[model samples]
Target: MPICTATLALGSVSGSLLFSNTDIASSNLHSSSVSSLLSPVSNFSKHSQRYCCSSRRTPWVCSANKVTSNTEINGQTSPVLQDSSVPPTEAVRQARRSADWEAARSYRDSGFICEGRIEGFNGGGLLVRFHSLVGFLPFPQLSPSHFCKEPTKSLQEIAKGLTGSLISVKVIQAHEESRKLIFSEKEAEWSKFSGKIKVGDILEARVGSVEDYGAFVHLRFPDGLYHLTGLVHVSEVSWDLVQDVRDVLTEGDEVKVKIISIHREKSRITLSIRQLEEDPLLETLEKVIPQDGSVGSDSESISDASNIEPLPGLETILEELLQEDGIIDVRICRQGFEKRVVSQDLQLWLSNAPPINQNFTLLARAGRQVQEIQLTTSLDQEGIKKALQRVLERVP
Candidate 1:
């Protein structure tokens, strides 16, 4: 059975009577239409909310699918066996709920975008007024199209202004049993803008929101409207290890990002911030060490180090490598050592090195700023020459 509520609350009708003369005369309810008094029902939620502020009417009749407390001057409000006035069986509830969800699912499966008003907001996200059932627009599901209106304003302020305004959204989820109906404005925008660009294309974007895993950036199309939002994973945020994304990205920061990947079906975009610059991990090592992992003869080999004077100790070798242009510090260490070298220089402590056949590390700054390069080998009484016999020969 369909869920319908058609109530006729007769203010002037006589008690225990369908219609009476004395009451109708005093309240002036005689002018009310009699035909609506028999009609079953129409819409429910939107009309049920209309509460009569003042008194004056022929008859309060709600001809909607649901019973409304307030109705216009039509005997339609009569308690004519409406759905709410009587308890419904499980089959009835399931039937109506299923009908509502079927319509919701149609919107989702068809990719039908529609205008919905923001009824209110809560901690989780915006509450959209969608007929009798309120659909939820989760904060994560909101797109740049929705937030770009006031890019710099706090979320609360923007939601306040959106309370009654309509926004274009599509149904992303509609599950009848769990009572979940979700909407996404972002997904709707993606269908419109995803075709305009492709992978490897560079675009200017604003950081809309930052989370522990990554930052969501709103891509600014050439037309100036933010049409799509993409994710910038924390690992792609920089060449340096990022412990916290907030340390580098904040909401509303303008940045240029490269599209590393795109998934059209999922409407996802992977972006990178570090790929814009050259990787300098090997800049400081190329001149000093055999890249092929071989010890070459003094002439055919380390040509860059041929002019170097033989060093007496590890500290001496440090002085020589530091002579390279823009080389700030040199460190040689075995792996699994202190990760920090840019902030503090412990190079002067090289005098504490143990002598002979011990696996040691030699670090050199070859114009790569303060980045550490690890070179592992044995060190003997002959000093650091044992570690760098290929690049710096023993002094006779």
Candidate 2:
């Protein structure tokens, strides 16, 4: 039996072969024929030795010491050999797996994580982690009640607790590779709000700041400090001319307001404070005395003789009118008249009196010099007297 290690090319086998030491001399084959048959094997051994030992390398090689043998089948001789070598396939697979694992570890090591604490806050937003990675928590994101007209003292008090507390966060965004980190305590709070709060909820808030244009407020809510500030536009603050907002509302005032809108993605909360109070203008107009100066018989208009032209003694009339009405420190300007009235009401009176059109100017002496006022509207005599009386009463 011949032990066969075959290199198959399609359906046929070829290559060198080896055999054990067994020999039989055949009567039909001459010695020369045997020598000729072995000659090819000898030459094959020399070629194989040169191929294996040569500096020009290949993937496989055969050692020379092994004896070569030959067998005949179908008039063709096949060479057999003892030793051959080729690289194993398993080494390549192991290398690829190692490379993949290393890449994954490298990615994990390079990822970013942030940690800080909340600090101070303002009407516009919260100021946190000052002097060490300060972050802003906008009013809406701070809490679900962030949209209240005014944030409560409790919310602010909770914000106070945020200071110096360690907060773990991630670097969700970066700007031009800068060290600046945009953080949100409110972002974390939003999930809780979505679960708890619904549309059309009423909340209490505190006035944070009042501007000529509007007012800012903070709202109290769970999850974080939230604000529900909005504009109490000069028009909305009062129907009367609002020369300044500070005159109406100041910081830290408590107010009840309603939520008009909540934009969770944009993190905005709209609130209204004026809705809580009665319209001041309507109240004033309803209470105002008419120009004719008749108030249910108790109030009466001045006599017609009071309107007539008079003698030099009329100066006394003017003096009596001033004394009885108690008008003082009168100043007139192009638009109207300004005067201090000495009365219980202590009101400041401004009016455009007779012979005054939009272009008409007036001059009046309060104490020393005459001041000028251009009239903006025609005045009603009864209304003027009544207004003067009101002012005089109000003056200290």
Candidate 3:
């Protein structure tokens, strides 16, 4: 029989190995063909700094037949190893995993796209065979193409149809200490089109899904297909207050959104639907308040003389606050808050929430620079907690 003549080297000795493709299963070690394993090993060795057998099961090492410790090849003899000199199984596994982590880190740093096959999935996400070690592809990291309009389709139902499918993904995170590898298909898609788009660019989008916090929208590319996804936060859903995000947008809703911000490194896009339209609050009160950088016209200025308005209610409160040190602007956003018993006040603050009645996020200016901005409320901290709880309850 003709012997298989694929190559392997030990130190200075370089010669053809006796083992072949069929040798692992066969009683005879050198009788089978070795050509099948040659290509993969050759490709791997070209890039790796160190050479060793494949980091997989390594069945050949455990095979019944063993090569003699003393073998001469091309007039160069390799050093003979004693029985105790072999590396431990756990040590070899750790080394292999360490190398894989480093390789994954490099891929993340370089934004390289990798193809992995879905082996299976669990509640957490899809498990992919990323080269040698298994990697995780979280549901949130999935591309919009994987989602369908069917509301009945659960996460498991969506992922169930994707098993054995090959997917292009990027290594979003690789932590050696935690031994975690997080992959993202959306990031892979982002790398392709992020350069073509930018912040403030209006784009057509189709809503992928709706949650209380925001709606996920897929940005349509020039080719008329959704390529990237961005989140339209609830506050950005409309010019008016958004009680619930689902009230404004839903799955498959076709809309045009303005890109408010783009995070290229993190592969995130912040979109705004309200920005496409004028802010109703600002528009309704435009004559009352001046635009950002321009001073108000004398005729429309709120502070302009108005025969003294012949009115002076609670002028003492304003007079006392304005008299305080470094208190330049004392504009009141809202007034005439309804008074109620402490119990009723607590209930309404919890139910209607965010303590909208209270003054929040106002800064006092000193000279030309602004000073401390405070977030205080008429109700205590528990009211804030209840308000947040109510908000989170509406999130999908």
Candidate 4:
């Protein structure tokens, strides 16, 4: 009897082949002909090499329909049989895990971007299942569009409407040992503008909110329509002292700021309101304070002002200068334990006022000089009286 050779395409395994007919020549089945039978398994593994399938010991049965051609597997020609009852082998499961882990790493390093459907909320963030893995997207890592501002609503309650929403995300952290995967929709969103923003760039911004430490500004760039949030630290708010951010800034206030720093790793943009304006104190000092070749030619006199005693009757000279001009320029000569000595056009104003730690310049007469001028409340009459009394007492 002339024998017929048949090939079976199994439901699960990729490379396994079942050949039954003994009389037919193997040469007759060309590898090209069996490509159709391998379609199911090839399609399953296109995303990642990791795949799982049944590893049952039961023999796979071939139906009356037979595969007429040969198939390729791992560079060699091979083939499958359908086994309905078998489960995947332990070896297969491990291989699948290994492949999945490798895929996760690729996604992390290469920034494999993907979109996930929001399944639920974990009270602090959204839970999303993506690519056969479940990852947590923390609230802080969520895009501003999805963030809830309503204080009365719970995160889950506020996110209830987002249960079916699809969000674009990137895998940030992935660990197979702990089965932990972290995703950030915010990062994915910011990638669009990463190339556009740069340090020293000026942005027209609106105050988003004021915090104790700083204020967040919604930065507007001319090239992009999206608004990025940049932080303006309290110290960067203005040239003048700021006791409270709320005092200097309020929500929705439109202002211009300069980008001082960009932290790409953290996705943080640091802004400065002060940078947008020239520093008044420094600018004034540069203009009035004589440099090396100027009127104050003696560089040694400008040397460390620490050891130099207040010129004999220096306080008297300062009071005289203050009286003449109504306001004398005080150059910070040096600060000591309990006193600070300042110079006005080469003259000294040594006062027992508690030493001033900050670099400051003020236009003021003797009446405004205080022993310890409070930066925030320098206009206080009583504080100036105390300082003037101390200076006058030193003269006589």
Candidate 5:
């Protein structure tokens, strides 16, 4: 029997010793013989093999065992090394740490979600263990629920409460050489909810915050989880124009909203409160205006118009139209609004005064730029006059 030599090398990482065995077999060594003699490490492609280790309980057993032997020119047999009783040294541990960071980067760039156990806490965030590598999840990146609720509790106490919990996270930043591994639990939370959402889905939501342009709604799904968030533009608050979102929705207000758009990659959800409500103009047209093109007497129509509230800027524009053109014919058109037939000059004003669209716009009023005004109502001559007065009184 031809004998092969096996060499056991010892290395240290942070005072811990590791053993690696290199085995060189004879040129004619059988493949089965090698498998029977050496246990297999993790099977990774050449590039990945350095960073990923075997699933074995011991860390010392490595990919080196999988190396195939090369034949010598003189037909000399090489020694087969089976490492045994080697403890992981400081250097080996550092290398593993480097490997862990590399693994984190791979997961992040590939948009892979990882599940990890919360090990402990640091000043910046909680320490999360992804397999053998430990990653950092900053407190800000944590789910909103993780913040310390008790005023008396310190941040360390809050972190301690989360220790030992299993959490799902996405790699946000990963630097192997610099030993930086950052994860985001909040992103992971949204990712889990993203799959269940669709456009036109109605959901119960609470106003999280109100901005000038729109309001952020914390959506409650069918599962009763309030993890998803959506935005409701001011235009979507009501059928009538909205000058302030605060007037329509206060913080914590419960509202039914329809999902209008969804941008999953951007983690954005657009919602509409008006979609869940009947358009006031449509309602009035159905009840007040008969199918025979009759709206009762002119006085009755005036009374109906008086009951309807026009949008802020609409009254001013309509009052100007009414003053110039007497006895205006106000009729609801098929486009969900009454057609206003003003003089050609007034038509230019309608086109240039302000645009009525989904977004807000700044308008020059009294030689100063004023906040956006949305006109979203169908109204009679009387209603227009009243709304105009209100708009004029508020303008600077």
Candidate 6:
């Protein structure tokens, strides 16, 4: 047989096959002869296929492996064998740390420390001063347990008292461009008071501010923070007319109050100074004296008698006229007639009284008088007299 040469293109190798007539006739002599030659060559190609290896990207491969098998490539399996031992990239690790640091810095920069002092105000809000800059303490933020309900006058008084007091406060915020520091005495007090206070507790406080309608009292037990300041309304402070809050209370006036409400999370306190005093209605009722004088006597008359009873004689007839309509203790006077009636129906009765004759005049105790009523001569005097008598008979 002639010599036959087969050049295989395995990996980068490229060639062709050359076979003589004698070699073909020999390979075709039997099926097993053809298989033996082809099987050995196919097995060698599978084992000798070379794979390029790379460590920089994913799916690292080894060049020693002639048989190619696919592994991770572009995050998926490739048609070549690869190394599975490569570690994560350094850039990814650095990016994660950078993200963590940025998150921390953002959290740090979101908070700040501010400083301010209590300034004068009247009812609207507390004025705070910081290095010639001004801020506001809304009524809601003025105290830990007490909120000023009607703050108009109270703020004014508080502003007056805070004028010279050196106060320390927390920075709620800072207006950098304005150079304004928003401070909160309430917030500082809340840090200490949130744990101690509850609703319905009575507290002793000082009057830090007063207004036409109310007063702000600094609580003693809760510390000297303005957040613990209790409010005493003008109506709550006294039963008398409160033309001005300054009349009854001044700054630094120590007083007692009650805690009406508390908002812990919001750090709000609602206090009442009036709760320390007796209710005005109850007090006045307790002091009221029982009636003791005769119903028709001078002592029984109102202190002002311009509307009191007329002469006793006229009172008898007036009582008769009033009795017809369930009126009692009827009193006739020059200025006006007065009586206590069960119903308003007595007005009609007064409009129908018999006209007076001869302009007669009469006097009664408490310096009241009964003037004459104009009448017609033809009117029946005896019938009118009988009508009066009949009306009196129906009264108890």
Q: What is the C-alpha lDDT of each candidate?
A: 0.54, 0.38, 0.54, 0.51, 0.52, 0.41
- Order of models, best lDDT first: 3, 1, 5, 4, 6, 2
TM-score of 4: 0.49
Q: Show model 2 residue runs off by greater than 4 Å.
A: 1-172, 186-202, 221-229, 260-265, 283-396
Model 1, span 90-176: residue lDDT tens: 223233334546667878788877666676665666766444345677676677765776766777787777877777778887766
Worst 10 residues of 1 by lDDT: 48-57
> Can you tell me which runs of candidate 4 are displaced by over 4 Å?
1-99, 147-158, 206-212, 221-227, 250-254, 278-396
Q: What is the lDDT of residue 314 in candidate 5?
A: 44
TM-score list, all predictions: 0.51, 0.33, 0.50, 0.49, 0.52, 0.32
Deviation from native of the Cα of residue 201 in model 4, angstroms: 2.0
Task: Indicate the TM-score of model 5.
Answer: 0.52
Cα lDDT over the full model 5: 0.52
> Which run of 10 residues does model 6 get worst, by summed lDDT?
47-56
Candidate 6 clashes: the total is 29
The residue-by-residue lDDT of candidate 2 on 274-376, one tens digit each, is 5566654223212232234323222122223223232222234234334433233222321111233222221222232233332333222222112232333
Q: How accurate is candidate 1 locally (lDDT)?
A: 0.54
lDDT of 1 at 162: 80
Select the stronger candidate by lDDT from 5 and 6: 5
Specify the poorest-scoring 10-residue window by lDDT in model 4: 1-10
Output the lDDT of residue 152, model 6.
40
- Tell me the tens digit of each residue's lDDT in model 4 across 1-396: 111111122121224222212201332434554342223212122211122221112232445654333333324443332222222232232343455455667777887576766655644566665543445677666654433234345556767767766777777877676556677776776676666889989878778769988998877657433336789998788765555899999976878999999998888999999877776544423333333323222112222344434434444645543443223344334312212233332222222224344322232212212121122223232344334445555555
